[model samples]
Target: MANYINPMEPEIKYNIALLYFNEGRDEDAIKILKECIKLKDNIIKYHRTLGVVYLTNGKHDEGIKEVRTAFKLNENDILTLNNAGCYYAIYTNDLHRAYYNLKKAADGITSNTDEYTKNVIKKNYNDIKLVINKIEKGKPNDSIKVPDLRLLY
Candidate 1:
């Protein structure tokens, strides 16, 4: 196994964490992600995935912290922007921040981006736009229901 050969490799650990996460093993994913970060903190995916894991598990504070850290590591990364946008919108109720990030991400999409990714970003952007419109038209924020935030692999 790659992990067996490179036990200390951050990517290997990160991949393992992702596998655990996909398998619905949040605790195991978190543990491995933390270890991967300890092994190499600068890698953005480690923090991003960890943040997503935490957010999905209802650890809002921890998830937000990790997402912020990932942004600090690479603010221009489209995936980071998307994640932050969704996290801010869904968890923090910071529609302004969410709109900003989602807009940037949507605009930054290039030809290299896959169709699924473009669709995801567009959907998030549209959802945020709807929410913003409702608020501008004097709808109560709590009354407006936003859909789940989609994450990029």
Candidate 2:
């Protein structure tokens, strides 16, 4: 096994976990991710991906916890900020926090930022801004719709 040959390579386990997540094997992914984290707790990707996996599996609190850990590890990471925004928007309906995260990510973009990541962050920020504007214009809370991230290829 690759892990047996390179037992210290947490990335190997992390990559396997990502593959399992893409295959919808959430429990398997979680198992390996936890192992990966135990091997190397400081990797932001491990925590971020684990957060996403937990959210997709409806483990809201655990997902938030992982994301919070990632944020603490690197608050300036645009990807983490964008994901935090989307996750809070979709799961917690905490528009304020979501908008803050997305705004930070959008503002942090530079020439080095890839087009796909820029578009995704901008789209999420604009979607949240629209909802906030609607609320500011006296729209009822019942009329507010959570932002959705779909078809962003």
- Could you say which candidate leads in lDDT? 1
Per-residue accuracy of model 1 over 1-153 as CA lDDT, tens digit each = 353477788888888998999999999999999999998899898899899899899999999899889999998878889998998898889998999999999998999989998999999999998888888887454587777779764
Expressed as tens digits, the lDDT of each residue in 1-153 for candidate 2 is 353458567988887887888898999999999999998899888888888888877898998898889889998988888888888788878898889999999999999999988998999999999988888886464676676752111
Per-model TM against the reference:
0.90, 0.88
Segments in model 1 whose C-alpha atoms lie over 4 Å from true places: 1-4, 138-142
Clash number for each model: 0, 0
Write down the TM-score for model 1: 0.90
Q: Cα RMSD for candidate 1?
A: 2.6
In terms of TM-score, how similar is model 2 to the real structure? 0.88
Model 1 lDDT vs. the true structure?
Answer: 0.89
Off by over 4 Å in 2: 1-8, 150-153
Q: Give each model's whole-structure lDDT.
A: 0.89, 0.84
